[model samples]
Target: MIAIIDYDAGNLTSVERAVRFLGEDCAVTRDLDLISKAERVIFPGVGAAGSAMESLKKYGLDKALHEAMKAGKPILGICLGTQIITSFSEENQGTPCLGLVKGEVLCFPDDMKSPEGEKLKVPHMGWNNVTVLKDHPVLADLRPEHQFYFVHSYYPMAKEAGNVLAETAYGLTFSSVMGRDNLIATQFHPEKSGKPGLALLKNFIAWKP
Candidate 1:
């Protein structure tokens, strides 16, 4: 079974629906054994990093996630879910995170502006094209610049450039996908991203790395 980590801080129904649509089994749970034993794990999060981390710790899911990494199980994190996988986040006033990936989650600069000199918006809502940087199994057969749904003010700056699988531009370029070993995460929400997104989800389910 594929387990979706339920730390009580994510919008998980959409992910569940998408996985089921692919004709696979998935479960939402905070149980450590379930997460550790699953064929794959989805660690999705929304809301503030501080609160989300709180819940993860409360249920010992943080430790369980570490265990998943050590075992080399395939795991995917979505959006804020993506952020907490990193070392730290500027959100919730400097929250320390999972550190699974060598990166920091950062808010878009308040003074960030487009090259054309227009002020860029925070929370980069709506559809944006992801430029696949390195070939990743999750993006193996995807077309270039396929659009994905994104809704966040923060994005990760991966310390290890090799882990960056794709990028997207807001006021400037930012990492959209990061993958290393059995771990992968997306800053965009595949559940709501339509065709390309569903294709991504399907690819993820089939990915063995």
Candidate 2:
């Protein structure tokens, strides 16, 4: 069974729907013991990092997630979920995150300019193409030319260069997907990305590492 962590974070329903659409067993819960024993965990989030972290701690889900990670179980994070997996984030007044991955989440400046000197959008919403950088089980049957749905203001700056699995271009090239060992995550909403995203999620479900 896959445990989907719920901490009052946005987009939980969408993720659960996607998982069920794939005909898989998933429980949306905040229970620590259930999560710890799950075959896999899907840490999906869409909200403020500070409040999210507070909720994680309030329910002791953070420690449970860490326990799963240390056990080498496969885990997937989305959007803010991915952000909190890092050390810190500039969101919601400089929130410190899980530190599960060695990196920091930084905000996109409002003044960020395009190559053509045009003002780029801060949150970088809509569909964007991701360039595959390395091979990973989660990326099975995914192509670099494919685009994914994204809605975010900040992006991850993974300190470990090899952790970056794929990247996408907006005003600048930013890390879109990252994986290390049994942990995998994406900045875009695979749940909302339609066919390609569903395919990726299917791969994630079957991925062992």
Candidate 3:
């Protein structure tokens, strides 16, 4: 069974519903034992980074999650869930994260000054298009320019370009999906992205560690 981690963050049910729609077994629990035993673990969140990190620590979930990942199980993180996998985040007073991936979570630059100098809206809400950048199992059947639901102001800047599997253009292009070993994360809400999203979830479920 797949495990949808429960940590009082919003959108957990939405994720669970999507999993059930795919006709798969998923358990939503905070129990570390269940998480460790699951074939694939999903960490979904939509909240303040500092608060989330505190909750994770309070529940001793940080260690549990790390143990699961270390055991070479496939893990997927969404939204703030994705951010926590990174080394640290500048959001919510700069909280230290899971350190599973070598990167930092940051907000859109106030000056809007990249080499490209692109200007777009903040939060990057609603449906946005993501272009495939690298090949990965999570994106097995997904095509370039697939539309996915997104709702966030902060984005991930991967330290290594090779870690980026998909890019999406907002004020400027940013990492939409990142993959490293058994770890996979997406800034976009695949659970709400319709058929393409469901396909990706199915692929994740069938992914081999």
Candidate 4:
């Protein structure tokens, strides 16, 4: 069964629904045993990193996640889930994160401009296409035309360049997908990205690593 971790981080139901829609058995729960026993874990969330970390520790999901990663379980993170999996985030006055991945989450610069000299908006909300940097099973079916939904001002930056799986361009290019060993994360919300997003989740469900 797939466990959709519930840490008061928004978007849990949406991810659960998406998994169920794909005919996968999943549960949105904070129960430690459920998460530890699940074959796969989906860590998807929306919200501030500081509060999210508070909730994660409050339920001890942080340790559960660390254990899952160490066990080589196929773990997927989305958006805030993706950001907080790293070592730290510039949000909330430099909040420390789960440290599952060697990376940092940084906010976009205040003066971001598009290539055409147009001012780009912060909190990069909307659809964006990713440039796959390295091939991985979970992203095997993704095509060049496929775009994913993004809604955040901060983006993850892996300390190791090899961990960067994909990148997307906004005012500047940023890591859109990151993975190492059994853990994979997306800066975009695959659960809300329509067909392409579902394809990603479907691929994830079938991924061996």
Candidate 5:
């Protein structure tokens, strides 16, 4: 069974529904034992870094995540989950994060603008395409034309370039997909995205790494 981690960060049900639609057994839970035993774990969230960390600590899911990573479990992170897995976040007056991946989350500059010189908004919402930087099984089926849903003000910057899997441009290009070993993460929401998104999730479900 796949464990969809629950720490009160919104967007849990959508992920659960998507997983079920793919005919996979999954549960949104805070049970440490259940998380540890699950074949794979989906750490998905949509919220502020500060409050999310507080909830993670409150439910001890933070430590559980570290344990799962150390055991080489296939773990997937989305949106807020992707942010907190980094070392720190510029959000909430500089919040410390899981440090699972060597990187920092940074907010987009206020004066950010598109290449065409058009002003781009913060919290880059709606559909955007990602440029795959490195190949991985979870992203094998994704084509250049495939776009994913995004809604975030901050984006991850990995310390090691090798850790970057894909990048997307709003005002500027930023790391959109990152992974190492058994862990993979996406800045976009595959659950909310259409066929391409579902394809990514399906690839993840069968991904051995």
Candidate 6:
């Protein structure tokens, strides 16, 4: 069973729906015991960084998440969920993150321009093609130019370049997929994405490490 952590973060329903579509037993809960016992835990969010952190702390989910990671259980974070895994975020400017991964979320500079002379837009909404930078089980059967849905302004900057598994161009190439050990995260919204996105989820469900 996969446990979807519920702490008032947005998009829980979509994630749960996808998990069901994958024919997997998934439960959405705030109970730590359920989360700890689940085969995998997915953290999905579509909101501000600081508020999400507060919600996690309020329900003691943060500690549960840390413990799960320590146990080497698979944990996947999406979008804002991915941001919180970093050390800190410039999203709310003073917000601290889960620090599970060494990185920071930063907004694109207004003057940032792509190689094609297009000014990178904020809240990078729409379908963007992701270029897989490295091979991993999460991206096992995924094609190189897999299109995923995205809607966010901040992107993660890892301290070590190898942490980045995929890169998407938005004015400049940013970390689209990050992986380490039993953890995986994506800045894109797989639930919002179509077939390819669903495939990625299925891959994650079947992933060993």
Clashes of 2: 0
User: What does candidate 4 score on TM?
Assistant: 0.98
Model 5 Cα lDDT, one tens digit per residue, 96-120: 9999999999999989988889888
For candidate 1, which ten residues in a row score worst on lDDT? Answer: 140-149
Compared with the true structure, what per-residue lDDT tens digits does model 4 show for residues 1-209? Answer: 99999999898989989999999999999999999999999999999999999999999999999999999999999999999999999999999999998999999998999989999998899998999999999998889999899999998999999999999999888889999999999999999999989999999999996
- Candidate 2's C-alpha runs over 4 A off are none
Instruction: After superposing candidate 4 on the true structure, give the runs of residues whose Cα lies further than 4 Å from its correct spot.
Output: none
lDDT of 1 by residue, 4-49 (tens): 9998876888889989988999998998888878999988877899
lDDT of 5 at 200: 92
The lDDT of each candidate is: 0.89, 0.91, 0.86, 0.94, 0.95, 0.89
The lDDT of model 6 is: 0.89
Which scores better on TM-score, 1 or 3?
A: 1
- The clash numbers for all candidates, in the given order, read 0, 0, 0, 0, 0, 0
Instruction: Compose the digit string of candidate 2's lDDT tens values, residues 151-187.
Output: 9999988889899999888877778887788999999
For each candidate, give its TM-score against the true structure.
Answer: 0.96, 0.97, 0.93, 0.98, 0.99, 0.96
Quote model 1's TM-score. 0.96
Stronger candidate by TM-score (1 vs 4): 4
Tell me the RMSD of model 4 versus the true structure.
0.7
Which sections of candidate 1 miss by over 4 Å? none
lDDT value for candidate 2? 0.91
TM-score of 5: 0.99
